[model samples]
Target: MIVHLIDGTYEIFRQYYAPRPGHLDGDGREIGATRGVVQSVFTMLQDGATHLGVATDHVIESFRNNLWPTYKSSAGMDPLLLGQFGWLEDALRALGVAVWPMVDVEADDGLASAAAVAAADPRVEQVVICTPDKDLGQCVGGKVVQLDRRQDKLIDVDGVIEKFGVPAGSIPDWLALVGDTADGFPGLPGFGAKTAATLLARYGHLEDIPADAADWDVTVRGAAKLAATLVAQRENADLFKVIATVRTDAEVGTVDDWHWSGPTAAFPAWCERFGWPRLAQDAAALAAARS
Candidate 1:
């Protein structure tokens, strides 16, 4: 009844940098991150997750790059980690997990889209978006929630307000004002988290804020300077807001398609190739038990 959507891109990056032993295939290609992701997915399956889907960036550069020239790209990324992106997708598919290998759009878009679709399904009890990414917070509400597996935290609608000091709907506006360095957009000057949150808590959005600082009801420090910056960079802030917004139109297919049916026959061979022969047996045993 619960649908779990994973951020495969984040998992790969997390595992690659994690303090664990490195792994290489017979050809000496790095696959430590791929192996780690497979193990992580298996843990989720073993822990009673039935409906699952993973979203990965098939190409790191998405449409956001075209929107903002400085948006996040694959440049300077560790080749070892980058090389495993495709391999991770293949491994997950071989393990019988639904994989969304995003191309022009980023992985976050796929998660947002899938979360939206799953949340709309009447049969779904809850939709858990498994990522700590702030952008995903916009999708939090009703039956949908964000789960940070690493932090062991669940962020619901109220949790979004508690953490950001603004409601879930105001996340893009907040990010636009405060800036998101990860997404390669600098917001208006003199706007930090507290200032943005405080202002947004009252106005609810960018356009609604009064142009004059004197008209503002909030008590943020440097109100005049902040108001001046907002006036000067209002256009830029709107553009950044567009960049911060996650696209929910990705082709994630139906929620029924996301059910975990167990590993495929190719999974065993794929595991051996990755130098983890025991993973094949473990996966098969788990599949049989679940079946």
Candidate 2:
């Protein structure tokens, strides 16, 4: 069995910006993103993904905000995008899809936790983390790979090495050094992508990097300034390391909660509510075929 964990926040964002049009129910309600998720998951299941779980931010504020005041906040996000979170969760559940509504933890944390637990189960052949977020790369193990559903690409341990130029184990350390704008953190001032990759490739971690730029050999420009900045912000670096690391210990109730048993008997009702005659037909057909 291959466990598929999804990042619901990222999906909502993607659907919001996608070329798709807004969806209206028979009652003239908006559920476009919810409808998009349904379409995406159907494609995943039809494309050979078996066991699946989708994690969404029940609330955007998490423990990371306590660590850094400047961390990404859901505050000021577009209202339309924010409005879809609940509708999406409800729609997913109404369709019998497994949903993790994250609160103090996060969507990524749920994916990490599920991946860790599922990977440990000997019956499971592999665990697939489905998201393009770089933070989740830290959880990639030999049996676990990251699959970008949008791009139709699968990245293994070697792909992590190829793109990040560092092993999966060192991704958090590399991210801490390079910082991530998407996560709302600034990395060291002088460090660029190449320089960080080169040093991390050699040293494997931030602490292992030499204190003296004079001893460097990777030939990154302004190595002295980079070295000084790292040394000066050592505490900040460690904090960033903690922030960059995804917690694989979220208290998800159980894997049975995530089994992909297909859509519910209410599929037709849900489709009628959403005004998706085509999806209603597809669900009925898929359910009947499975039966």
Q: TM-score of predicted model 1?
A: 0.98
- Tell how far residue 134 is off in model 2, in angstroms: 1.0
Model 1 lDDT per residue over 71-160, tens place: 899999988888899899999999999999999999999999999899889999999999999999999999999999999999999999
Model 1: lowest-lDDT 10 consecutive positions? 282-291
- The count of residue-pair clashes in candidate 2 stands at 0
Assess the local accuracy of residue 26 in candidate 2 as a C-alpha lDDT between 0 and 100: 75
After superposition, the stretches of candidate 2 with alpha carbons farther than 4 Å from their true spots are none
Candidate topping TM-score: 1
- Expressed as tens digits, the lDDT of each residue in 36-60 for candidate 2 is 8877877777776667888999899
TM-score, every prediction = 0.98, 0.94
Which pairs clash (backbone N, Cα, C closer than 3 Å) in model 1? none
**Lowest-scoring 10 consecutive residues by lDDT in candidate 2?**
282-291
Candidate topping lDDT: 1
